[model samples]
Target: MKHLLRKTTAWIAGAVMAGGLMLPALAEADTIKIALAETPSDELAAFFVALERAKANGLDYEWTAFSDEELAIQAVLSGQMDIGFGTPYAAMQRSRAPIRIIFQLSKLKFFPVTTTKYEELEDLDGEPILLHSRGGGTDSIANVIEERLGIEFGERSYVPGSSNRVAALLGGQADATIIDLSNTNKLMRSPEADRFNVLEMFEVEASDEALFANLDWIQNNEEDVQIFVDALLSTYRDMHEDPTIIRRETNPDGPIGQLPEQILGELDGFYGDAVDAGLYSKDGGGRVAANADLEWYSAAGQLEGDPSDLNIEDFWYLAPLDNAMN
Candidate 1:
């Protein structure tokens, strides 16, 4: 009897030790890895807010920023990252990456600004235009313009940074450039504001950024993904109802907080412009935005085939987002 009791106690102790080891694994499973197409900026303020909320909800996450969208997409494809930022339509169509967009983050709110001499898009005919890069958002915009307006502008790509593009425009390196919302606002407020004019460009009914992940990983981590989407959807709703929520949730120690004071000060204005421009979707988990993305990307030549034939359900996994929304 004494021998049997000793053996039972030993077995119980071993089982407890095994369970202790498994605890860390379970905790680690809750963490998600995210990849950013670019460094954090004022435009991603609400996303940062969602990150904070996710932390509170026990969904820990880490993010890495690549220099460009291509690198970010590659990281996700190789499984080096769990979630990537941009929707690589061409890459997806060609390589058949098992990636599905889970969330539509923002819309294409880009603007074309040029020297005062050019008053409209028509005036840019045959003129050199500074673009973000080949096969990038700015390039897509240029392609759409050429197709719609039946005019071709010489393309010059020196750097991918919007500030660099803005500098090129201000320094007269290029007569016209397409820049982001923040830079557009900065130029409008600059002392040289009168020297430039923001030409009206056609509105792009497409997503500027999205949350995409490997299909297998998404399937395995559906619960965690739902938590993340829930947090993000709530944050978006909060922002739409009260734009000031962005300022209220600004974490001084977070990524956006580390920005230069000049940029930081412009956060309100940047968000204000975004809000006025309807850059964000009110239906956080609806398919309307996804359908629009297909049409816009197809028109821009980013994706092959007709937009009407492409089913958005193939590219998007709406379950997680829909579950979060409800």
Candidate 2:
């Protein structure tokens, strides 16, 4: 009886020790760190909606916003963040970062706004144009324009913010500039509205933002990734089916609610414009958008070699998104 009791006590102690060692691993597996390329704005309203869903599903995530996409990319590359927002095509291709895009956040819906001096795209040839940043969406648009129209404009990236770019155009610091949907609407409604003209922008079937993560991290946390993607996919479909869902799901104590009153006031209009413009992809998996991204980026000189030669599988891992969609 003593010998049996001693064996039982030893087994219980070993089991407890093993369980203690597993606790931290379980906790770490549940947490995800995300990085955003830009500050919280109306453009990210749907993401905020999905975040609420993720929380409800027991997925823990924390995010930080960086001033630029480069910084966000670096954060992910350094393992400081598990996921990153932004399309960093060139940097990813050049550095061969082990990042794979899992979700397409938004389509390219930027507009080219200019002072009254430039009435058309051609009119701005050889003139200095304000863009968001080098290798950003606006810069890609400029690249496509230069290729299609056979014209070149002096590119200036002094201001990375869309609102600041609009201000530059209004203040005569720039003759022409490209700004996002919100800034475009604000400029159109401003007192100086008559002074600016929105040129007809060429449409590109490219994504403005994508959710990417390190390939190893994704493989290790496949289940968590799927859960996050599933929540996001459902949120996209819900938003498309009912645009007002954005206002409904917005948490009063959440990030969107915490935004300045003036910015929050524009939320309805911002999402309304997005739905009207077909900004969000109806297909949550982003397969079609992924193909389009290759072509658009390659054409814009953001990617090297022929787009046809590039395999979508190389840059995009659709398993998580695919599982989410189904």
Candidate 3:
């Protein structure tokens, strides 16, 4: 299947060489190779729907799930993939790869969760916290919180997943941290949920996950790129207008379709909540998101320059999305 949700591999060449495992052959020259940062889930139902629409329009593609977002960015930078998923603001600034984001898949829709000891962000001024990684999205959220709220944290620890981190909280390991929408929902609904609080977060419009590609490749594959963006814009708009469309359009034979009924049952609710929360923008975040990304990423310590001084065109190619909207 082109949408191989679980298509993980030995991440590096050295790992493959050492393990002597047979890696799948690379995609054909004309095929669009997509690097997924994580396994497909209900959150990606709309994205897979867009891919299906693009395929019907003659888009040829295959996807591989990388172990993490950074690996996906590296794959695209190494020319092993044509398109990738990540908010690669740091990579775009630090590397000369000409990588430009084409679509903002989702925004920084995270929430601050803490025990009753903390009622708001200000309450954790000098408290220790847990996050996904040191330089990842959640870590950047913490950084931005400190910058915007004028408070400094005590210690930052890494725990990788929200389920695990919430357990850490249960075990009295940490009191406060940032978590995604789904995990926050799960935590707040648990038996011991009364002990936790979902802090009121300021509106964040910055991109958390986006579709990016090398400028050269994007220029060379303009037609396919337009098709892909057109499909994505259509899907995003439709989902926002009527979030249930995601579940309706999900392919029964695709990877997302193969998910267990328990998980699949949550598609409509998940996307509806996402739409209600404004996790996605109708125009795939052409200029507004790019600008917000500059401010947010700069505050998060991912991008070095002042938000106002950095050029949006340097990080985002808004033409495809603009064209799609028009």
The C-alpha TM-scores of every prediction are: 0.87, 0.88, 0.87
lDDT of 2 by residue, 95-173 (tens): 6456789999988889989888788999988888888766778788888998999999875665678888877877778
Report the C-alpha lDDT of model 1 over 235-266, residue by residue, as the tens digit.
Answer: 88888887778877878988888878987787
Give the lDDT ranking, best first.
3, 2, 1
Give the Cα lDDT of each candidate: 0.78, 0.79, 0.84
Q: Give the TM-score of candidate 2.
A: 0.88
lDDT of 3 by residue, 1-326 (tens): 24532223322221122236443232323668899877777767899999999988878788988756888898997777889988888999998678999999998899999999989899989899998765778888889889989999989988766667888988988898888787788778889899999998888888888999988778877988999999999999888889989889999999899999987888888888888888888889889999999999999999997899999999999889889988
Ranking by TM-score: 2, 1, 3
Q: Give me the runs in candidate 2 sitting further than 4 Å from their true place.
A: 1-30
- CA shift at 211, candidate 1, in angstroms? 1.2
Worst 10 residues of 2 by lDDT: 1-10
All-Cα superposition RMSD per candidate:
9.7, 9.4, 5.7
